[model samples]
Structures are given as C-alpha cells and as structure tokens.
Target: VERRSASFALRMVVHIVGDVHQPLHAADGVDANHPGGDIGGNARRFLPDCNATNLHALWDSGGGRYSLHWVSTKPEWEAMRAALLRDARQMVQNRTAVAAMDPLRFASALETATWEEAVEALSMSGGFGLVRQMIGESAGIAESEVFVGLQMNPHSFGGPLPCPDAAYFANAASVSTQRIIVGGYRLSFFLRHIAARLRRQGLLVQGGDNVFFGVTNAWEAAPNAALH
Candidate 1:
C-alpha cells in the first residue's frame, strides 16, 4: 500500500475504534416502549431541555446540541474538548488491563472494514459481539449509564422526559473517556503485534514508532484537566 493509503487506513482504524466506544453505536435501544426501535436514539431526545434532546445524541456528542453538538458555544466546546482529551489521557495511561483482553476484534473488523461487498444487503446487521468484546462491554454500559435517568421517571422513546442530572453527565463522561482510553491501548497493541510479526519474518524495520494519540503525555501536558 502507498504511504497515504497506509496512513489513511491507520487513521480510519483509530477513528472507528473511537466511534465504537460511544455506547449507542453498539445498541439499537429496542423494547416494549420503543416498538419502532430507537435507531441508536436518533429518533429520541436526550432530555426535555438538553440541546441534543436525544439519548443517542447525548452520548454521541458529550452534552450538547446537534451537528455542532459540542460546538454550540466556543467556550463550552473548548472546555468539553479539553476535558475529553484530559480524561482520555488518564484512562489510556491506566487502562493496561484492556490490552490483556483476549482475541481483539480489530483483526476481523479490519479485514472487512476495507472491503467493498459486491452485493449489499437491504439492511445491515449489528447488535453485539464482532467488536473485540466491545459490543458486550458497551451493552453493559448502555444498560447502566444510558438507562439510569429512566429509572427516575416514567417515560419511553421520544418524550418530554426529565433531563439527566449533573451526576449522570459525570458518569457518562467517565465511561466514554475510559472506553477511548482502552481504544488507544488496543490500537497500539494491534499495531505493535502486527509490526512484531513482520520484523520476526525479516520483512520490516525494528522499533517502529508507537502511535500516540496524546494520551501518554497527559500527565505533563494537561495537569489541570484532572478527572472530576
């Protein structure tokens, strides 16, 4: 592959891994209340007052409005960005356990990720597994974190449901950040493992660069952005 293709591939892997960490990406949010299926909360609102107003958007954009969800306001957007990077950094440094997860799914995803199927199905299928145990893990988070506010009130699907409280955002942020941290760890591990195999076969150079998503330097870089 050309350098650009390789680099693009690497970037896509990093981006997709991050994308999957968003809880809603792994869940369809179907139940008796939502007979039509939540469609990853796209049809619903996050809260009666929250800008996103949809459960899926809430998790996808980090407590903000649509399109420019996190960018509704410059100051608030910057703050969210800073917090995201800071928390992700901390989790990356502390998420050593994630690397030990057996049979990372990136291999399979990567295999199919680049391929263009000749015959496209009417509807794509997805609802657990096939994501390096990520679907299973995220399902647990969706159950606990996303449905948390629901326990406080009586509503379902689209509605004037109560807004999630400060406590809820805190929990969501933590979960999202930690998942990204594990993502970086898994991505790093996958690349290194691949490179090592190539080196062993005398196909490439040794001691290749470790792809740093700025998490490793969080301590020295964003000391003020500590977990809250």
Candidate 2:
C-alpha cells in the first residue's frame, strides 16, 4: 500500500481541508421544530446581489461575490485569491490572540452533535473518525452560529426568507473569512502531527519559509447550535 501512503494521503487532505473550512459546506440548517435538518440550507432561499438564489449557494461562492456567480475561470480565481489573501493578512494581524485556540478541542465540541445525527457508529475509526468530527463541527456551525440573530424557520420551511441588505452580506463575509482561517489552522494540526511522526522515522516533510500561522476558536458554548 505504498502508493496509498503519504503522498496520496496528503492529496486527499488538501482536497478536504479546503472543504471543512467553508461554513456552508460544513453546515446544515436545523432547529427543534424540524429536527431532520434543512439539507445544508438548500431548503432556504435568499437574494445575495447575484442570481445564485439560495442560502447555501451564497456561501458556496465564498461570500466575497455578493452578486451570486461562480468563479469559473483562472483570471476570476486569481482575483478572488488576491482579495482572500489580503483579508487573511488583515485577519491574522487582528486576531493574533487566536493562536491559543485548540483544533482538537473544537473537534470534540463539534462531536457533541453527532449523537443528534445518530452517526456515532460510522464515526468509529480512521478517515470516518475525522469526517465524522469535521462534519459534526460543520453542522454545529450550520445549525445555529451563522444566522447572526436573524429569524429562520424552526419548522419544515426553507427559510424565514432572507430579505437581505448590505449589513447582512457584510456579516456573512466576515463569518466566512473566520471559518476559512480556522480551516487552515486545522489543516496544519494534521500535517504537523504527521511531521512529528516522520521525524521519528528519520524523514522530514519540508515546506518553505516562515509560513507558520495560528487559529481562532470554534463557536461559543451556546447549546451547540448553528446555521448556514
């Protein structure tokens, strides 16, 4: 299984690490009334300047493009990446305190939601263990944290319906940025651990420069609720 070791594992990690950082990608709109969940906010609709139309769609585009559209070309991606890097730089400066936050602690807090989803068995070992934990945290954020005090349906409806304004989009973007930062920190947690093990085996995984960074906290202990 040498082919499935190290390099392959690293590739998979890269793909999924970006995913877990996306608040909406990891979330599900849920409540006491409809305990079954809103299928990751697909059940809700809103207008976010662009025509993407749903709550999930807005986040799927990274919330920077309020005018709902996809990043389909290299040029578009480059522009978006530049904006993101700037935001990330500023975020790092502003939240220098986030360095103390623990990804493992956050993972456990998110796992509290797994019992609600009845996935404890699947969350048993290896990749399933991490997936279960990450997705649980994602759902935890989706179920309550992202809504920002707005009213949403507690029952079976898709939304309270977003009659959104400028402030709403701004808050959405802010939340998205925070989540993305946390995602990078979490990715580092895995690689750094792997590096420690590799060092024991007389190997090293090297990257360039002083590219090290930190993390922010998971949602505050508000009964483990979240929204997308």
Candidate 3:
C-alpha cells in the first residue's frame, strides 16, 4: 500500500464511511430496472412541494436546503449541523440493519417527520452490525489512498496552491460545498417529516431513531431516478 498523509486519509475515511452507509451505494440493481429515468434524483417527484424530484438526488443534495437563508444565524445552522453530525456518528458507531431498516423505509418515502414518532422509533433494536463491517473494510482503502497522496504532495488537491487551476476546480468545489451544507442530515430531516405525515398511510418509522435507506432492503422497492 502507498503511504498517505494523515489529514488527507482522515477526510477520505470519513467520506468513504458515509458512502457505504447509503444502501443505494451498496445496491447492484440495474438502472434500467427503474421505471423512472435515472436523473440521479432529479427525475422522480417527492411531495412537500419543497423538493419534488428524484430520491437519489434528494438524498444527495437536500441536506443543504434545510439551513438555507431561512435561518438568520450561522450558529443556529451550526448547532443543527452538530446535532446531525452527532446522530450520524452514533449511527455509524452503532449501526444495525434491522434496527435501521424500518425508519429507513419510512424516510425513503419522503414523508413528514415529527418528534413524537422519532422518539418512539428510537426505542427499537434492529441494529448496525452489517453497516459497521462494510464501512470498516471499504473506508480503509480509500483513506489509505488519500493519506498516501498527501504524503506525495504537500499541497492538497483541493487546497490552495500550485494545485489544479482554479477554473478546473470551481465547479467541483461548488458542488462539494453544496453537498456538505445541503446533504445527509438535511435530507434525513425532510424524509422523516414526510414519513411522519404519511404515518396514517401505513408508513411508520421503524428501529430506534435511525433513517437509513436499505437498512433492510424494504425501501429498495421505491421508485428510482432512472424510473422517471
């Protein structure tokens, strides 16, 4: 294995863990199988009038929208981000497919969320063992490469420097920033809201406060971007 820089490796490891946590990423399904055209979350329509597009895209980008200019202070946003980060960290540390699958399915539907239901769901014990295992194996390789790269170059690839030209990086950086702000936690909130709203419709948040898709492959039945 190549030698990698510690900082570079840490970030890569963090990202790799997140990627594997997403059930869709673990899926080997055929895109053509979905009735919706695969627009990467842009094709399918979700409710709430806020985001009415593809599921994958919402999961990928919706986290940023939650903290939009709607809030006046960055502190509020940071607080929410911190809480989310904590929940995410817990999810990674104690991931359980069975415990997570129920809420995962509920969230996948894009329904409304409520604290009452969230509290109830958090009491179950489906578990994150499989999630932890996969993350451990996959994230390691990615981090090694990232750290090794850092060792080879003092200037980070995205860091300011004799790195890539600014124009070359502009679009990529913008998108990356967008994901950090609008993805993950934000998306989780939106879906939880949707689930709470649709609770009357036979949808319920399962497990204990976790909402990961494919926690048990139930949401795998939902429409995909390619299906649009």
Candidate 4:
C-alpha cells in the first residue's frame, strides 16, 4: 500500500504539515475519488472571473513567485538573510530535544490516528520542526541558484506577474501520476511567488532566501481555485 512505502511516508510528512495548515485542505468540499476528477479542489471550474484550478494551484504553492519579485533587490536580500539566520539560530539553540525532533516511525503507529491527527502531531513534533528547518536550508539553495543566475543574466521585467521569469512546464502520463507530482510543483512555484513578494516588501530580505513563501489564502479565494 502507498501508506506503507517509506518514500510515500516521507512525502506524507512534507505534504501533511503544509496541508493541515491549509484551511481548505482541512475542509470537506470535494470528494477525492470522483467521476468529475475534482480531487480536492484541483478540478471544478466555477465562474467567469475565477479559475479554481489555477487558484488552487497558487494556494498549494504557498505564494512563492510573488514573494521573490518583491524581495529581488540586493539590500533587501542582505538584511532578510541576516535576520533569518539569527532567528533560525536562536530558535534552534533554545529548542528542547523533544521540541526539535519527530523521528519517523512505522505506519502501524499511525493506524489509530486519523491522517489529520497524525499530521498535526508531526507538525508539532521535533522531527517535523526539523522539516521546517530544512525548508530554510533547501530554500537557500534554490534562491542562490536563482539570484546568481539573475545577477549574471538579468531579465527585463515586462510581464503582468512580477516574476524573475515566466514559467516552467512538465508532462507526464496518467491522471494519478500527473496530479501526484504536479501538486508539489504547483505548491513550490506558489511559494517562490510569495518569496518574491516578500522581497519586494523587504520583510523577507535575507530571510526571504531561507524562507519558503507560498499562497495560503484558499478559503478566502475559493472561486479562484476552481477554474481549469
């Protein structure tokens, strides 16, 4: 079973922590297995102005693109990074062992708990806290790659969206396969957008590089997530 797979379990950790934080992820609007294929708001076109599919994708990504553009300049990056590192250090330093780790356990232990409950526990657990920490670490790498690439080859910002560039696409066979991976990509992209926005505001200057920003206002923007 998928739940039994180690990789699946790990992905579950990554997803669930973020998922439960999403209000819509916790709500009950669409069925997972349906003829309409409207799995968790990813499907279900709604109105003329809103694209549920697109909106849901944005929320899933955690506002990544927006954050990056806002925080693009040099001075912002330096300040944000310094603040983020200091905060990360202080947080980790004072954390208790129990508060800092949530070692992976066999799926059997999760049997009694609902998926939501397990996720909440993991979010509160030290290991999951470490997962949050790693977000900073990984974000640092992703941002550095983007920043250096931009400095060496600056692109003229001429688009509606304030992104460093346009977009990236991928393809896959089978609905399940497509949805499974696309979910991660969508979420990652939105987070980058959020980082870009924070950069613009200078709230996430240095920390922006380390912070994983993404859209998180799904419940407020339900109509938007239904298109396409």
Top TM-score hit = 1
* By TM-score: ranked, best first: 1, 2, 3, 4
lDDT per residue as tens, model 2, 1-228: 232365566556555765765666776656663378666666666545444466676676555453344387999978865665555555455333444454445344333343423233334544566556667777677655566654465233434464445566677767666666666545544544444444465444344331111211212211011111
For model 1, residues 16-77, the per-residue Cα lDDT tens digits are 65566667777776666677777876655545566556677677655432134436788987
The alpha-carbon lDDT assigned to residue 3 of candidate 4 equals: 18
The estimated TM-scores of all candidates read 0.58, 0.56, 0.29, 0.23
List, residue by residue over 1-228, the lDDT tens digit for candidate 3. Answer: 112232244335335434543333333222333344223323333334433133343334322223223355888867865655553443334223422533234343233435554434432334443334444433342233211211122143322212322332343334333223223332343333434444554434355433322312222211111111
Pairwise TM-score winner, candidates 2 and 3: 2
Name the candidate, 1 or 2, with the larger TM-score value. Answer: 1
The superposed Cα distance between candidate 3 and the true structure at residue 180, in angstroms, equals: 16
TM-score quality measure for candidate 3: 0.29
Is 2 or 3 the stronger prediction by lDDT? Answer: 2
Candidate 1 regions off by >4 Å?
62-85, 94-132, 151-160, 194-228
**Residue 164 of model 1: what lDDT?**
72
Model 3: CA > 4 A from native: 1-4, 28-52, 60-73, 85-228
- Total clashes in model 4, counting residue pairs 3 or more apart in sequence or in different chains: 55
